[model samples]
Target chain A: MSRAYNFCAGPATLPEQVLLQARDEMLDWRGTGMSVMEMSHRSDEFVEIAETAEQDVRDLAGISDDYAVLFMQGGASSQFATVPLNLLGNSASADYVNTGIWSEKAIAEARRYGDVNVVASSAGCGFTTVPDQTGWKTRADAAYLHYTPNETIGGLEFDFVPDSGKVPLVADMSSSMLSCPVDVSKFGLIYAGAQKNIGPSGLVVVIVRKDLLGKAHVKIPTMMNYQVMADNASMFNTPATYSWYLTGLVFKWLKDQGGVSAIGELNARKAKKLYHFIDTNPLYSNPIDPRFRSRMNVPFILADEALNSAFLKGADERQLLNLKGHRSVGGMRASIYNAMPEAGVDALIFYMAEFAKERG
Target chain B: MSRAYNFCAGPATLPEQVLLQARDEMLDWRGTGMSVMEMSHRSDEFVEIAETAEQDVRDLAGISDDYAVLFMQGGASSQFATVPLNLLGNSASADYVNTGIWSEKAIAEARRYGDVNVVASSAGCGFTTVPDQTGWKTRADAAYLHYTPNETIGGLEFDFVPDSGKVPLVADMSSSMLSCPVDVSKFGLIYAGAQKNIGPSGLVVVIVRKDLLGKAHVKIPTMMNYQVMADNASMFNTPATYSWYLTGLVFKWLKDQGGVSAIGELNARKAKKLYHFIDTNPLYSNPIDPRFRSRMNVPFILADEALNSAFLKGADERQLLNLKGHRSVGGMRASIYNAMPEAGVDALIFYMAEFAKERG
Candidate 1:
């Protein structure tokens, strides 16, 4: 089977091996006489699948006893509303760090629930850099400080985690989750939509410090209540089972590849190879601050705007697909996610150099 | 190529042909070089998939121009909250007819959003029959009247649609949708969890009248807002693409085997065959009132409850699995959904007779 290297921001590429395994097990799963999708969530067969998926996540993320990991639906967007509903408690305010489009969206949703304090913003800098943490104006009694670690749209990332002292810190790690090692204990909550580096689009993984549970406002629906979800193992309602199963397979594949540490090295190499080419080549330019350039999503503009279509068309001919940047950013983005092999990046770099030489 | 007859309640059986087609197109969907799961929701490929899926649903359900069909997540349970949130509007209350576990759950969730008047209830009769609509004490100005047409757990079904007049009728058809033909014009809204008769667990099909849009309370999250989902074509967030794709295939298969009108006849025949066997056999009994018996889920008890273990074991040995009744109602329930062939029911009847004879 010929598979092109996919570079879409999300609903993105998945490990080819996981797809093959899924296909092989599509009819019957381990003598259970049913596919994972066909198994009832309450069935012992599916209970094991859910449990193993959670266990793999815990192992990979090094989550401690203080954190509860939940596999939920409605994507990260759902979490935008859910986070505030669960965390705000009696407090009517929270701090938001605006790094890019995603954080802005999160802040917008949070405002409906409470008073949002824009602690620091990179918007004034064209969202190309992470604002200095010292510039944040956080309320001492705010519910929590929320930020997005990597913004898929702007290809901006935070090189370091922010400190919130006693106050809880919540991060939307949708685009950068599992791409590198993370200290699970540092944040009060961390949530990521699975489309980028986990497995599928429909499932969202949330890790919340245990003490934060059971504080959702009384008006919160059962499905949106973190405490209820944690109590029921995220099965308070029917979960996105097939997506969860695919996530489990991807987790297993990650472990077999020596966990996040090993994958992180390979990812660093891939990003460096591409970023280095763009930096030196006159034909290409990436505007994001060097410190905050996302390793997963690399957005670059061609020197001549007219050549943009030609670049994408030529790339498509060579079997490189979904390289167009997000419409908000309007350029080209090469999302070298975990599923993307280093060879894919090398091929892209080779093509870029050839294009530059021919154009010059 | 071996496949078991899956008897799961939700996340249940799918058309074998649909699964086969999904498997065939798993890697490269229609030369897009991407799995349906990998395609961008905005891409022309997925847009076509989404449009065709909606059109197929419209065709199968005979939906008129006045109705809008939405593909949503969170299952029927989410709709419990969303229904009232969207329709309750400026009204402080709505009327709910409680028939079984599902309707009770709906009422409980609706209570969180608004005052729910229990217009009628079958719990008084142990959920064996639907309450007479004539006796319903519905509010004079209820925003809407909600009921479950078929309760999968209780094995009770409403033989006739309730006349709500201008109050607008909403039905949870999760267990009975498309099992038969109905006048779509009678109800303001209808929603079905796809697992039972539609496709899979994660996708819910919501059919709402065009007039019901934009009435949601101000604080309702954008994802749960019916109007937002309708406007976005259910792509407000990443949907369950695989489940949606399978549902589209099922719609095509249904069209091939004649529309809902023809399928309804086959379903009625299947239910009659099983019910006749139970009514005549001395050892088998179904407690549901005959008029309210469900054609989709038939729950029967062995006269000698001790033989329950033996009955289930025998059925499993014959590859008739998941015949064990719901825990709340301890008896055998054979969910003969749309995908269960007549031969499967025949096999079930033959086994039931043999088991009864041996026990006697």
Candidate 2:
């Protein structure tokens, strides 16, 4: 089977090895006579699968004992509302750092539950960079500070973690988690939708400090309540088992490649190679601030707007797919997630250079 | 590959054909060069898949243009809150018929949003039968009447659809959808969790009257808003694409086998064969009211409680898996969904008679 390099920001490309493993095990998982999707969530077979997936995620993230890993549904967008519903217990407010579309969405959802302080915003600069955190006007008694580590749409990323002082830091690492190494003890909670770096679209991985459990407002739905999910080990309902299983396979693949640090080095190299081509080539340009360009999603615009379609057409002809940028930020984006090999990056760079030379 | 008969109530048994097809297409679907799970939801490929799935469901259910079909996530449990949040509008109350565990849970969640009128309740009868609709205490101004057509745990199903005149009728048909033929226009809305009969656990199908759109309370999350989902054709967020695809295949299979009418006949025959064995056998009995016995889920008990373990063990030895009943009512439950062939029912009946005769 010929598979293209899928650069879609999410429901993005997964490790080919993981796909092959899933295909092999689709009918029977490890002699369990049933497909993972058919196994009861409560059964020993599924329980082990779920546990191993959670454990592997924890290992990859270097999650500490203080943090509880949750496998949840409804994607990261649901968590935009659930995070506030669970974290902002009695407090009437929270601080938000608006870096791009995703961060702005988090702030808007949080406003439904409490007062939101726009502690830092790059909106004034067209979401090209992360605003200076020192300028943030944080509330003294705010429940927590929320931010998106990588803005998938704008292709902007935070180069460093923000210091929240006494306030708990919550990061929506949907597009960036597992692409690099992170200090687990530094944040109160980190959540990522598994589509990009982890596995599939339906499952979300959440790591929250244990102390934050059981503090959700009574109004939170049982499924959205963190403590209940934590107590039940993310089996409060039948999870997306197939996605979780795929995630487990992806996690195993990550370990085989020498864990997160090793993958991080490779991801950085892939990002640098692609960025260097875009920088040297006059026919294409990436507008994000140099210090904050995302390693995962790289959005670029054509020198000639009319050539945008031709560029995408030429790329598609070469089997480089999903490079069209988000409609909200129209241009082009090549998301190079962990599953994307350096070879795929090199192929993309070669294609870009060839396309530029022909156009020039 | 050897496969076992999985008896999970939800995330339960799937047609072997679907699994085989899914495995074959795991890498490339119809030469698309990408798995259904990896395709962008907005891409023409996925859009075609989603549309075909919806069209097949409509054909299977005989749904008309007046009805809107929506595929959503978070299972039917999320809809417990979303249904009330959407339909309640300016109305201060809604009517809920409490038949068993699922309905009771739905009532509890709905109570958080508006006053819930317990129109009828079978809890007094230990949830073994549907409460008489004539005795219902529905409010005159209730925005809608909600009911679960089949209770998976209690193995009780409504014998007749309740007549609500102008009051919009909403039914959670999670366990019984596509198992029988029903007049689609008779009810204002119908929702089902896919695991049991549709496909897998993550996808929830909702059919609503067009007039019900846009009434969602301002506070409801966009993911939960029926209007938003309907407007976007259930692509408001990244959907459970693989599950949706599987459900589409299941729908095609059902259509090929002469749609719901033929399946319903088979389902009835299966239920009768199993129930007749329990009724006539001195060593086994089913306590649910015969009038309300579910054609999908058949729960029974061993007359000699001590032999329950032996019964389950023998069934396991014979490969009659998942025959063990729900935890709340522990004895045995044989869920005969659309996929369970008549031969499976015959095998189950033969085993039950053989085990009963030997034990007696």
Candidate 3:
């Protein structure tokens, strides 16, 4: 089966090994005489699938017993509201550090729930830099510090984890999760939409400190209640079973690849190679600060605007795919998540060189 | 490949044809050079998949332009909260008809958002029947009247639609949707989790009257706001792409089987044959009121209590899978959804006869 280097910034590329296993098991998972899709969520087989997946995720993250890992739906976009709904306790204000488009979106959604203070914002800089922690104006009365460490849209990320002091550090890790190792204890809650490094779309894995539970707003919707989700092990209702199963396969695959630390090193290498190629090439440019360039989603632009569409077409013809940048930020972005192999990045680098020689 | 007669209630059985098609396309869908799972939600190809699925669903339900078909995540359990969050509008109270377990869950969730008036409930009768509409005490000022048309747990169903006067009628059709022809004009809204008759677990299809667009509570989560979802065609966020595509395939299969009407006839025949066997056999019985018995989910009991475990074991050995009843109403259930072929039902009947002869 032929495959392409898909960089669609999610609902994106998954490991081929995971996909093949999923295809093989789509009809009947492990001789259970029923497809994972066809099994009852409450059955022993399904329960094992869910528990094993959660455990492996915990293992990969090195999570402790003080947290609850919830397998939920509606993506991280939903989590923008869910975070404020389930946390915030009685606080009127929450701190937000905006690095790029995703953080802006998260901040807007949080505003609907309560007072969201823009503690630090680099939006004025065209989202090319992460505001230094020293400049952050975090509120003492804030419920938490919410930030997007990696913004999938702007090709920017924070170089260091923020220090929130006594306040909880909550993060929307949709684009960067599992692209590297994360400190579980550093955040009150961390949620990632699974389409990136986890599994598929429609599933979001929320890792929240256990103490943060039961603080949901009085009017919070039942499904958004973290405590309810926690108590039921993310089985408050029937979960996205097939997606969860696929996640289990991915978790297993990650473990086989020597877990997150090993994957992180490989990811770093890919980012270094791709960024190095762009940095030296006068024909292409990545304007983000080198320290702030996202290792996961890399957005670069052509020196000549006339060659933009042609660049994409040529890349597609060379089997380098989904290199188009998000419409919100016009240019090209290659989101090399955990699933994107080094070979794929090498191919992209090769294509860039060939395209530049032919058109420059 | 080697298929089994899977009888799971939801996250339940899908057509063999559908599964095969999904497997074949899992790696690369329609020569797009990317699996449907890998494509961007914004890609022209993925957009077409989402739109075509929605259009075919609209056609299957005979939905008019006045209605908006929304593809969402978080399933029907999420919709229990979403329905009220979006529809409570200016009204402080809503009417609900409680028929079984699902209705009770819906009532409990809606109460968290607004005052829910349970117009009628059959929970007192051990949830084996549906309360008559004449006895329903629906309020004139109720923003909407909500009810479950099919209680998958008790195998009970509402035989007729409730008349809510001018109040918008809403129904949770999770277990009943697309099982038979539906009059889309009869209700202001209908939502169903895709697992049963539609597709996989994470996706939900919401058919709402166009007028229900902007009535969401000001505090409604962005993902749950019907107006936003309709305005964006359920693309306000990245949707459950793979599930949506599978649902599209299922819709095609349903249409090929002569649409819902033809499927309805076949479903009725399957229900009739299985129920007839239970009614005639002294060794088995179904206690639900005949008029209220659901055509999709059939719950029954062996006359000899001691043989329950053995019956399940023997059924599994015979390849009649997932026949065990819901834990809440345990004995046995043989859910025959649209994907369940009549031959599978015949195999089940044959197994039942053989087992009965041996044990009786």
What TM-score does each of the candidates earn? Answer: 0.98, 0.98, 0.99
Which pairs clash in the backbone of model 1? none
Per-residue lDDT tens digits for candidate 3, residues A1-360, read: 378888789888989998888888878788877789898899899999999999999999999999999999889899999999888888988999888778888999999988999988897988888888888899888999999989998988887888898899998988888778888899999999999989889999999999889999998888889999999988888899999999899999999999999999999999999999999999999999999899999999999989999999998887788898889888999999999999999999999999999996
- Please write out the lDDT profile of model 2 over residues B1-360, one tens digit for every residue: 367655568787888888899999998888777888888888999889889999999989999999999988878887888898899989999999999999999999999888999988888989988878778888778999999999998999998999987899999999999998999899988999888999977778999999988898887777788998888888777887777888898998898888999999889888898898889888888889999999988888888889988888887777677888888779888888888778878888888888878886
Task: Estimate every model's Cα lDDT from 0 to 1.
Answer: 0.88, 0.87, 0.90
Off by over 4 Å in 1: none
lDDT of model 3, residue B142 = 97
- Best by the DockQ measure: 3
Give Cα distance to truth, residue A198, candidate 2, Å.
1.3
- In model 3 chain B, the worst 10-residue window by lDDT is B26-35
- Candidate 1: clashing residue pairs, number: 0
lDDT of 2 at B186: 90
- The worst-scoring run of ten residues by lDDT in candidate 1 chain B lies at B1-10
Each model's fraction of native contacts: 0.48, 0.60, 0.72
**Candidate rank order under lDDT:** 3, 1, 2
| Cα lDDT of model 3 by residue, B1-360, tens digit | 267888889888999889888988888887666788888999989999888888888888899999999999988999999999999999999999888889999999999888999899887889888887788888999999998999998999888887888999999999999999878899999999999998999899999999988988999999999999989989899999988999999999999999999999999999999999999888899989999899999999999989999999998887888988888878999889999999999999999988899996
